[model samples]
Target chain A: MHYIEVQKKDFNVGYEYQQLVKDNSSDGAVVFFVGRMREFNQGQKVSALTLEHYPGMTEKLLAKIEAEAQERWPLEDSLIIHRYGRMEPGEQIVLVVTASAHRKAAFEACEFLIDWLKTKAPFWKSEETAEGTKWVEAKASDDQAADKWSEK
Target chain B: MITVLFFASLKEQLGCNGISLSGAGINTINDIKQSLIADKPDWSKWLHKPNLLCAKNCEVVNGDCSVTSGDEVAFFPPVTGG
Candidate 1:
């Protein structure tokens, strides 16, 4: 099973993990990732953040990322959850879970999903900082991270 | 007509979330961008920024990609979400 969602409601990580591994007795490992809003970024104190996305495009690209991960790994199941709208520091922003028959595949696929999601997804973020609210630009480091997976 | 969308800083800077352009002579993403600049001269700076990204029909695409009527095109600053 593969699950992907975008919503304003906060998610329960434990509940999501449970759902990821349920009814998959053959899977021996489950790796999940949760991304949270940071209090500081690029030398600025971030008090809050607002995330926006191209609604139809965001879901479509996420599903494509999940499909790519499934093809690259022996994944039994995977789930992706991303939140939008206003949020404060320490709040959950995104979650990714990958279940597989072994720990390595589960771990690698989980990381892959996050890496691809960073550069491929349509979501954009703006933070409330001490200076003022500003849009977050894509980082070169993120592109490098995603590029690593492309190396044959 | 081809639908165009903007997000994040571009959305705020352009002062519009989206717009529609006639498909005629709007074969490439760059063509539509030029048309936008012609109509809204004030948006030239942000619209022409080096980091601007484009997508056609929900798929990330280059400026040279073809666009047609009924297509949904989007332009935004490079993504920053996780």
Candidate 2:
């Protein structure tokens, strides 16, 4: 099963994450990832970050991503949450959790969700820094991460 | 009239979020792009970004798909946040 939500509050991704693994004693492994804002980027001090997203498309695309991960692995459950609006450094922005009967599938699928979410979702980020406010630029690394999934 | 929209980077780059256009035989995305190019040449470089997507009423679409007069067309760059 897949669950996805986009919100603006801090969530215990670990808490809901534990809930996904419940009632499935067969699952031997679960992997979770939380992405937080950083204090520095491209040699600059970051103060805050504002995330812009299409409300409807954001949830739909993420759900599709979770579904793809489930198809590739014997995943018991997957959850992805992305928070928007203004966020400060060291605050959580995204969380992904994957559960499976084995470690490899759980870990790999978790990584895959983060990878694809970066390049395929509908979110944009702008950073507020000491020098001035600027939008974060997309990186070549993100494309490579998303591309790896297609090679499967 | 069809509502032509741009989001995120595209909106900032183009300096406009969206605009109204009179839809006609200009049904496909290609037609809209052609008109936009004629109206604003600066966006030419971004038309072919590897991750750009065109959508009609929030559904992913191709450049040649027919767009009705009252449709909503959106353009956006690749999303890079996780």
Candidate 3:
């Protein structure tokens, strides 16, 4: 099974995990990653974050990324859920889960999914701070992380 | 007509969400951008950003990619999602 979602509301991680593992006994390893809104960034205290995305393109690119992951790994299942709109600090922002028969495949695939999502998915973030609302800049570190995968 | 859309800071900077332009004499994504810049010279600053991204009909494409009537084109900055 492969699931991808772009939603405005919060998701229940436990429920999503159960959905990924239910009746799937073949996979011995499961890896999941959760990304959260941070309270501070760039030496400033962030009070809120507003996520924006290209409605039609966001879903298309996410599904493409998930498909690419499946092709590269011997995977049993995977799930990706990302949220948008205004969210406070500590709120859940994204989830990625991968299940495979071996720990290596599960772990690597989960990391690859996130790396690609960070740079390829068309979601932008605007953070609210003490001074004013500011758009979050894309980090060079993120580009480097994603680039490493293509080198392999 | 072709529909052009902008997002994120580019949208805020351009001060417009989307607009429709005549497909006549426009051959590629670059043409669409040039036309936009021509109409609102002030938009050149945002639209011409070095890392600006473009998409056609929901797929990423280069400025030289061919476009025609009824296609949805998008312009935005580099992605910051995770």
Number of the top-ranking candidate, with TM-score as the measure: 3
Instruction: Report per-candidate DockQ.
Output: 0.91, 0.68, 0.91
lDDT of 3 by residue, A8-93 (tens): 99999899878777887899999989999999898899999999999878889989989988888998999999999999999999
Q: B1-82 in candidate 3: lDDT tens per residue?
A: 9999999999999889999999888999999989988888998888888899999999999989999999999999999987
DockQ score of the complex predicted as candidate 1? 0.91
Displacement of the residue A120 alpha carbon in candidate 3, Å: 0.5
Per-residue lDDT tens digits for candidate 2, residues A25-101, read: 88798888999999988888999999998867778888888888988999988889899999999999999888889
TM-score of each model, in listed order: 0.97, 0.88, 0.98
Encode model 1's per-residue lDDT on A45-96: one tens digit a residue: 9999999998999999999999999899999989999999999999999999
As a whole number from 0 to 100, the lDDT of residue A59 in candidate 2 is 80
**Fraction of true interface contacts that also occur in model 1:** 0.92
Candidate 2 ranges beyond 4 A from true positions = B37-52, B59-62
- The true-versus-predicted C-alpha distance at residue A48 of model 3, in Å, is 0.4
Q: Which ten residues in a row have the lowest lDDT in candidate 3 chain A?
A: A16-25
Worst 10 residues of 2 chain B by lDDT: B43-52
Model 2 lDDT tens row, B1-82: 9988888888888888888888765868889988887878987877656667887887778898898888988898766678
Runs with alpha carbons beyond 4 Å of true place in candidate 3: none
Candidate 2 residue pairs that clash: B27-B67
